[model samples]
Structure formats: structure tokens, C-alpha cells
Target: MQAQIEILASLQTVDREIREQTGRKQRLLEDLRVTERQIQAKKGEIDALSAAWSEREKLRVEKDRVFQDEGKKAMDKRMRMSRIKNAKELQALQREIELMRLGNGELEEELIKIMQEIDAIRAQIQTKESEMAAMQEEWQKKQDELQVEINGIDAAVSEASTRRQTIASQVTGDLISRYELIFSRRGGTAVVEVAGGICQGCYMNVPPQLWNEIIRNEKVHLCPSCQRILFVKPATE
Candidate 1:
């Protein structure tokens, strides 16, 4: 029973080491994911800006084409003005020329607006592209640093796992099984020290009879409150 208790204590140490290393690994992994997400978001912004720039350029080209077509139609209408003979026909032609000129002026205004919008979109695209590049570089640097930290943690975890296995091998099968059962249900603390008449695992006072029994160290004991295997340690350093 004493040997079994010693083995349980060793297993507890192993479990604690494993838990600490696992927590660190999880934190590092989360940080890596955050960095990756930041990079992706910046890239998405750049892509959106690029698409907007392309669409604005297309609109500008179509507007220019429309203006040119309108100008050509106005010239053709003027050429036809000299061929009209009747007064009524000449007044109708003059009215048509005035309407065409007004339409051309409206189209020219629209073309200028489109050109301005295209220029603004292009400028925004340039700024976004530069920002994306900087963000990507920062992301890469973070990735490299994170990779190094992850690698170190991986090695530590491997070592801790190996040590756990080694310690587990020294314990009897039944005792190890019982410890694992308690650890799985009780947050990796399957063993507790009995000191000052208290169950350190639960921070509850132990019964005097049981406390005395534990102090003798004749057999392994379990805390009444938490049911963790208890051991007695020397009071002095």
C-alpha cells in the first residue's frame, strides 16, 4: 500500500507537468490562428478595393464612349440642318439640335463624374495594397516566431509525455487505473498531502481519528471530502 501511494504521488507530478505544457501549447496555437486571421482580413480588404477599382474603370470607359457617340450624332444633325427647306421643318430641326446639345452636355457631366470616381478608387486601391503588403509581412514574422515557440513547446510536451509513461510503468496496474479514474474526474489531482489536520486537496479539515491514522503512514488514506488519495509529509524542511 505504501508503494502504491508513492507511485500515485509520482503519477500526480507527471499529470501536473503534462497539464501545464498542454495549456501552453493551446495558447500558442490560438495566437497563431489569430495572426492568420488578421492577415486574411487585410487581404480581403485589398481584394475588395481592387474589384472596386476595376468596376469604376469600366464605367469610365463606357461613359467616354457614350459622350463620343453623342458628339458624332450632334455633328450629323448640324449637317442635315442646311438641307431643310420649309419653315416648319427648319424649326423642328433647330429644336432637335437644341435637345441634342443639352443631352450631350449632361453626358459630358456624367463622364467627368465617372473619371473622378475612377481616380478615387484607384488611389484607394493603392493604399489598400500597401497596407496589405505590410500586414502580410507582419503576419509572416509572427508566424515564424510562433513556429519557434510551438516547436519548443512540442519538444517539452514530448518529454513530459515520455516521463509520464515511464512513471506510469513503475506503478501497479490497479493503482494506476484508480489514479487515472480520479484524475479524469477531479481535474488531474488524484493525490493530496495531509498536513495540519487538513485535506490539502479540498482544503477541508480531516477527522482527528483519520488524521492520526494518516500521520502513521501505515496505509494509504483517502480524503473524506474530495476522495483523493492522501499522504503524510514531514512537517519540518
Candidate 2:
């Protein structure tokens, strides 16, 4: 029975190692997840900026086309003035040409403004793209580092699990099940050592008779307070 208790203790140690490593694996995975999200967010921002740039470019093209068409119409009106023989008709044509020129001036100003806006949008797109590229490079590096750590943790957990299986085979099935239940419920400490008549699991005082029975090492004994399997280390010379 004492030997069985020692086996349970060894199993508990392996289980603790596995649990800690698994937790580290989860944290590493979450870190990778967060890094990936940041990179994706940067990409999304760059895409939106590019879309705006494209829209501005299209607007500039349309505005320039309109300005050119209006200028051509103004030139045609000027040519018509030379064909008119009547003086009043010529004066009227002159006024019509002047109005078209004024309208063209306003359109030209608008086209200039559109071109400036397009230039600014293009510069902004370039800057954002550069930023996204840097973020991707860093993200990849972080991902590689985390993947290596995750792989190491997986290997460690596998090794610990194999050892735990070997140790657990030495104990009875019912005892192993009970220990596992206690291990989970008690936060990875299913077996505890009693020293000076104290229940180490819960730090409560063990009854005198129970302490004596525990010392006999005849069968399994549990701390009344924490219900964990209890044992005492053999006295050393």
C-alpha cells in the first residue's frame, strides 16, 4: 500500500508537468492568434486606403474629361464669331464666348483641385502599404518563434504522458480513478505528505488514531480535511 502511494505521487508529478506544459501551449497559441489579428487588421486598413485612392483617381479622370470637353466647346463658339456678318450677331457671339471661358475657368480650377487630391491619396496609399509590409515581416518572425515553442511543448507533453501511463499502470484502476478525480478537484495535488500530524493538503490536524494508522502503511488513508491520499516519508539515517 505504501508502494502504491509512492506510485500515485510519481503519477501526480508527471500529470502536473503535462498540465503546465499544456497551459503554456494554449498561451502560445493565443499569442499567435493575437499577432495574426494585428497583421490582418493592418492589411484591412491598407485595402481601404487603396480603395479610396482608386475612387479619387476615377473622379479626377472624369473631371479632367469634362474640363477638356468644355474647353473645346468654347473654341467652337469663337470660330462661329468669324462667320457672322451682322454686327449685333457678332457682339452676341462675343458675349457667349466670354461666358463659356468663365465657365471653363471654374472647371479648370476644379480639375486642378481633383488632381491635387489624387496625388495626396496616392501618397497616403504608398505609406500605408509600407506600414503593412513591415507588420507582416514582424508577424512572420513572431509566428515562427511561437511555433517552435509550441512544438517543444507538444513533445514534452507527449513524453510526460507516456511516463504517466507507465506509472499509473502500477496502481489499481479504482484507486487511479479516484486519484484523478481528486487531482482535478484539488488543483493537481491528489497526494500529499503528512508531517508532524498535519494534513498537508488542507493544513488541518490529523486525528491521533488516523495518524497511527497512516504510519502503519497498511492500506490507503485519506486526509479527512482535503480527502487526498496521505503518506509519510520514510525516516532517513
TM-score of each: 0.82, 0.83
RMSD of each: 2.8, 2.8
lDDT of each: 0.83, 0.89
Residue 232, candidate 1: how far off, in angstroms? 1.4
Off by over 4 Å in 2: 196-227, 234-237
lDDT of 2: 0.89
Clash pairs detected, candidate 1: none
In candidate 2, which residue pairs clash? Answer: none
